[model samples]
Target: MIPKLAILRRSGLLTLALGVFFLYQSLKLELGSWNEPGPGLWPLLLSLLVLTASFVLLIGNSEGGAGSEKKPFAALLRDSRLPLAAIASLVLFIVLSRYAGLTLAGGIMLLAWLRLLGKEKWTTSIVVAAGLTALCHVLFAVALQVPLPEDWLLALWSAGR
Candidate 1:
């Protein structure tokens, strides 16, 4: 049988650490009245939940028998490329958006990501990128009243209007 103790130990440690961190953050925030929800309420509740779960896992592990070999770290590393690339692209998008405008920056980031990570066809990438860029433009600019960076191209286009 698989070792319950090993699972419990790992899960408990993670939970305990997360619980402490959340509790610290919650204490730092203004909790306000119980009648109306405050910023600190969610984190306080989550921390309590984590603490309880960690204790349960620790107790269960003590009662269960340990079994099986540990999985290789290489197995975890195998499928990380896509996430790494996506994170890098997101960072790049943030940097580029300051100069290139949200529409252009977001469009390029989406195209590159879809093409590189998703291995999407050019037509599909173009369509998806354009659609997403347009959606963001409408949402942030029109609906949310948040102004996007005006790049040279966008500035020229707006000047003509």
Candidate 2:
């Protein structure tokens, strides 16, 4: 296996290349003036951010400061449990959202993440999750009128009515 530093450098290079690709694609899109921002502006800005961060990561890890030793891939996976869990939970949320709608899926995701990953107390996690779910529902569904997908529960309720 490659050294951790080498892995990081390679990842940084990959990210930098992706950012450059995104920058090129975004530039090809129609970017309106500063006052009337077009579809491309947001992507362009995000690509720039990615480019900058990858550049910084590459520069910072150029020399061995810390965590530069070679370790097995298994060890790397073992050390990244939290991040892996977060990613897994995010994927779960995405799958759940398709069926459960944003509100319910977001609530479940928040509760699980706060309680399991964040190690928050049950009451605190439940309360915060519910609150955030409500806030998100109001923000996107009510205020922004985002036309979220119809939840199975909502469909059942309407059917019963």
Best by lDDT: 2
TM-score to true structure, per model: 0.50, 0.55
**Model 1 pairs whose backbones collide:** 3-67
- How do the residues 2-102 of candidate 2 rate in per-residue lDDT, one tens digit apiece? 77667666766776997899899999999998999998999899889879967775776676547675333324333324544665787799899987887
Off-target runs (Cα >4 Å) in candidate 2 are: 64-133, 144-161
CA RMSD per model (angstroms): 8.3, 6.1
Tens-place lDDT digits, model 1, residues 1-161: 53544544665676678778879999888787789878998779878987886666555445424673433432332333454476578779879888777778889999998899888999999999999988887888889998556765567778999
> What is the lDDT, from 0 to 100, of the residue 4 in candidate 1?
40
Runs with alpha carbons beyond 4 Å of true place in candidate 1: 1-78, 159-161
| Candidate 1 weakest lDDT stretch, 10 residues | 71-80
Note the Cα lDDT for every prediction shown: 0.73, 0.78
